[model samples]
Target chain A: MFDIVIVGGGGAALVAAIEAATLGKSVLVLSKHYPTQSQTSMAQGGINAALYPPDSCDSHIQDTLKAGVGLAKEAIVQEVCRAAPKAIEWLDSIGMPFSRKGEAIAQRRLGGATYPRACYAQDYTGLKLLHTLYDNAVKLGVALRSRTFLLNIIEEDGVCKGVSVLDMARGKVEQILAKAVILATGGYAKMYGALSTNGFGSFGEGVAAAMRAGAKLSDLEFVQFHPTALKKSSILISEAARGAGARLIDQEGQEIGGELWTRDRLSRAIFEAMEEGREIFLDMRHLGKEFIEKNLPQERKLALLYEGVDPLKEPVPIRPVAHYTMGGIDVDENMQSSIQGLYAVGECTNAKLHGANRLGGNSLLELVVLGKKAAQSAAQMEQAPQQKLFERTKIDTNFIKAVFALPNQIDFWERQEFLSKIMYHNCGIVREEMRLKGVLSVVRQHQKELAFMGVRDKSPLMNKELINFLEYGNMVELAEAVLVGAIQRTESRGAHFRADYPQRDDKKFLAHTMIWKENGVLCADFKPV
Target chain B: MKIKIKRFHPHFEPPSIDMEYEVDNAPTLLDALLQIKRQKDRTLTFDYMCRSGVCGSCAVRVEGKEVLACQHIPKDGEYIEPLSVVDVIRDLSVRLEDALVTLGSSKAYPLDMQKVAMNEEDERLIERQSDCILCSGCLSSCPVYESNEAFLGPFALSRVWRYVADKREQAKKEHIDAVVQNGIWDCTLCGNCTQVCPQGIDPKNDIVMLQSKAVQFGYQNPNLGGFGSFGLEF
Candidate 1:
């Protein structure tokens, strides 16, 4: 029995684990994948922390709340903003090797920021931060469990207990008994077929588990689509493109808008433009080769040195992709979930700081600020005995056999291509009632077929097919949730734009749309953000 | 286009499967696989993502060596297979799960509040090496990885050495000690890793960086003494 059991090994879990360990608690950190192999590692931009002399906590707070579009919890925003500096300082202490300028630090501006306050260790800041926290957590004596899948949560008499996890390497399920549980399992971006900078595991399973355990979800309709993901790859073209003087142009070389326009507006414009056979391009030529080579060298080098298109010489094709989810499991100021002895942070919980849309770099800021908060709160809780254990039935060999025995002769490439096409065409950056409803029907029809499908590989180790099955299941479930939420919401705001309701009707839809699976059906509920 | 794939399993004698794919004007290797998976057959397995080459997902052997499926253009008739001497988890996807896991297991630099300031030269030493995407492209192209599964590989070493070389990080000595295993010492100083890296993060420089730090720490890989020269290209 452990004092604390953490699900998901993103920034939030590592921070919480380290904090709990520092508080002298015997803790365990379980990740579905390896700790650093998370969507957190895919974060190319910097963490937004108000550290520069020109930037202030107040300014950061205001920018965040404004970007959240009236639904952000003001108090929570203040709390996170004030605590953000400490988190950055802590990361620096952990040897993050942040990029600096002269005597002062320099920050590259991103979308929806009032000031240059992003603290970074070059482009892969999150990877660096994850490494730092993971190392610190190990030194402080947290049991780091990798490749462990959470089977289910165990509870008794309405109180939180331990969890059952499948240790993939051992090919067996092990139940971990803990006094408390922290779900830092990240977001549901993988639900969308096309993802910009999202990992294969960002399926929001932790949030799903929370909902299954009766925790209320908030702002489920608030999904943030990044405005500039490469079309074929969905690799995020950082918003720093706009910040660094790149222009969004139509195929005919006309400007879309002031490139610095907010994310929501940019996404809508691009979506509409793509409808008119006007593919979008990020024009970095005007910025000169020096700027491209100096600051944004990766994009340029990848274009010229690798992909064979010099962005300085020509326009690179681009589009919007599902990036972040502003909505998730409802957590309070201390990052405590509705359930006692449970906490969530980072992309897993709804602090409501990023209400409808998240500003660039704030996602990183939230990880540190809310992550520290959850950890600090967990430490203060009176240490209690390990909770009741759930009875573990033997692994269903027949079911496993059936799951592994499905025909691997089916063409997954066509199947996935069809799924992605429908998803991208119907429920993409722009959506309508007719299209979303059609998408729901299509998903319902295909879910069973997908379940029965088998992948070619049966290797006992790193079985990509089995992993894809699980991932596809997650994708289906998350897509269903999104459609339900999108269909239910009558008005458009932030990333959830509806062609049916072209305006933001705050009077009717000020509250958040929360959806949960009840008896195999999606049930919608409302919660104040 | 006719393609031959080398196939081997512990359960069966090693053999090569000859497959055919239709090419439509400048098809990528990924396109050929897509055609094979869709039109021809579906038993063949491979790893891929962000099909346009950014994610470093679809890596496989084109002829005798490794290349990214998404980026490498297919020849009219080519022999392709899983990477050489690695545990092929199905077809193209090797058991790279260990690479990420092993790196995670090695401890990172401890937290220190006071930063060690450095000039531009110190910053430039590591700034370019820090952009690794964990694609394992470098590992796939590595000649040494053929025999030793425990080799830290180019990605991890580059990353580990990135921290070791950073002037801002105070625990350079500790970092040096942590990465000495099949970690920094096993690097052959081959430029193959650098050539294959899609992100242009030369693991060769990073390996050199690690060697310099290892010299500073008075430690050496017994086979290759500290600060020894390997005439590496680029």
Candidate 2:
């Protein structure tokens, strides 16, 4: 048995693996795809670090707490902000190739920050950071198994024993016993599907599996809507574009203002405008072609390819789409979850860091700092003896066979598409009591209908259909929790905006939303901060 | 639009075949492939994650030229197939884990670099090399790796150059030594890797830069010899 098994291939898993390996512990990293292909690579903006002059960690923490709308844990905010410079140093030491100023790392102003504190490598910040981490992990001899899908976290008697996975390359069900398992499998913003600015693999399966294994999830309702995704494709146009002086314009060629506002406020304004039968556009033509080509090349490429509108020549059509999710498996300051020997970091865990909404550029920073923290914490624990127990989990070899043997009464793809549409309309940027209730019922119905959904392709090797089917099941399961959390919280706050309530009711709903399963039934409640 | 997919299934009857489908409202090749998988066929397999060019998982060959499936708008009756130089896992998905191992073997990252300040000019010198997405499109078009698998391909070589040019990296001599064998000198300067790089990273130029550095480090091309020494007795 390995000392630590990381269940995702993103930046968090790599950092954790490197840390664990440095601690001289046996570690294995499991990924559904190549390690470099994680959602972390798609982060175009930057990572926050208060290393520039006139910027202090106190200002960064205050900005983060303000963006979080009173739900951010003060202690966690301070810790992350204080650790930002050291994290940047470690990343630089490993050759992150961060864009440099005059003998210092280049800092840019992301939307929610008072100072230019976000260190970047132009617009390809995430890609460069992920590659650097992956290179370091490889150099440190971290064992990585690609094409391994995590089916379930094996928990026996309230302790995480191991994980059950489907080896996609070998076409077999395997159980990997581990002393500790770290979940870094990203967020479920893609539950909005075509209306999401997430990668296709961000289905929150790791969070769902953790919840099934008795991990308590917090704040599953706070889904951040990016203000400037391409209108037709929902592909993200980074906030860095606006930071570079691009303006948000209405169809009548008037500036809509709030270009530098935090994501929630800006997204709500754009949503309100779009609801009134008006279109919004991101005007980057004023930034000039050379500047666009030099700094925001990815944004230009995305706008041209997805929407066929060149940002250098014309205003790019844009809208707010589901971008980041602040809710996930709840973890303490040590990055340990409710289950013993089970830990979570990065986008998969709600560490009370980005409470109601995430500040721009903080996600990447959290991935680095907390990823190393989880590994260090997990390494100090006593090694659990290797056990032959794999039959306690809900999914196993027989479970896969049964799922494949089920009658195909419903088309999962159609149902998934239908669910995405309804979720995007009802439970999306704007919500109310009736629409949320409607979507909750639909989610409950879909959960019940999951039994009849079967994979048509019974091929064992590299069966993407089976993987998609499992992702759909996980999405349906998590959608129930999101809807229930949204319906229960009567007050509008942060990204969980309730149109019916219309105002922040911090008096009653200042606590966090907690969701878990009790005896195969989903349950929800609130935890006071 | 009508598109032809070169299909391959190890467990199927014939193992390989060309299938055509007419898909509506499919703007990109990825959309058309997903449409076929959702509506027409259930067994079609391809790999994609971000559906943008960043993740680099959706690179395939269209009409025998490597391109990212999500970024390339398809023409009518165009052919889509797996990358030519890699092992096909299924229909249009190629195995890249083996190719990625070279990133580690080539010592593509900085080693033992002292913490030093860097300027924007030094950062910009290696900026284009750092933009490589590791898409393997370069490897697929690389003529050197097509015949000799031991040759470090374009992406890996470009990454080596990324560190060798960085001011913060102190182990430039070790990096230059690592690429002297199958890494830099093995490349034929064919320019195919530069032609197919979606991110516009010129690995050929990076290889030339590495050659210059290698010579400065007193390592000559092993294939070269003194004058009048072309296997003739003096």
True contacts kept of each: 0.21, 0.77
Clashing residue pairs found in predicted model 1: A93-B111, A93-B112
Give the candidate number with the greatest lDDT: 2
lDDT tens string, model 1, A47-112? 887887678999999998888777888998898888888877777666565677774455777777
For each candidate, report its DockQ versus the true two-chain complex: 0.23, 0.79
Per-residue C-alpha lDDT of model 2 across residues A15-115, encoded as one tens digit per residue: 99999999999999999999999899999889998996689999999999998888899999999999999999999888898987788788888898999
lDDT of 1 at A299: 61
Question: Candidate 2's error at A441, in angstroms?
Answer: 0.7
lDDT of 1 by residue, B91-142 (tens): 5656555555546544433523357665556766766665555667677788
What residue pairs clash in candidate 2, if any at all? none
Off by over 4 Å in 1: A131-145, A164-174, A195-199, A301-308, A377-402, A405-420, A447-461, B2-90, B95-113, B118-120, B133-161, B171-234
Which whole-number lDDT from 0 to 100 does residue A517 have in model 2?
Answer: 95
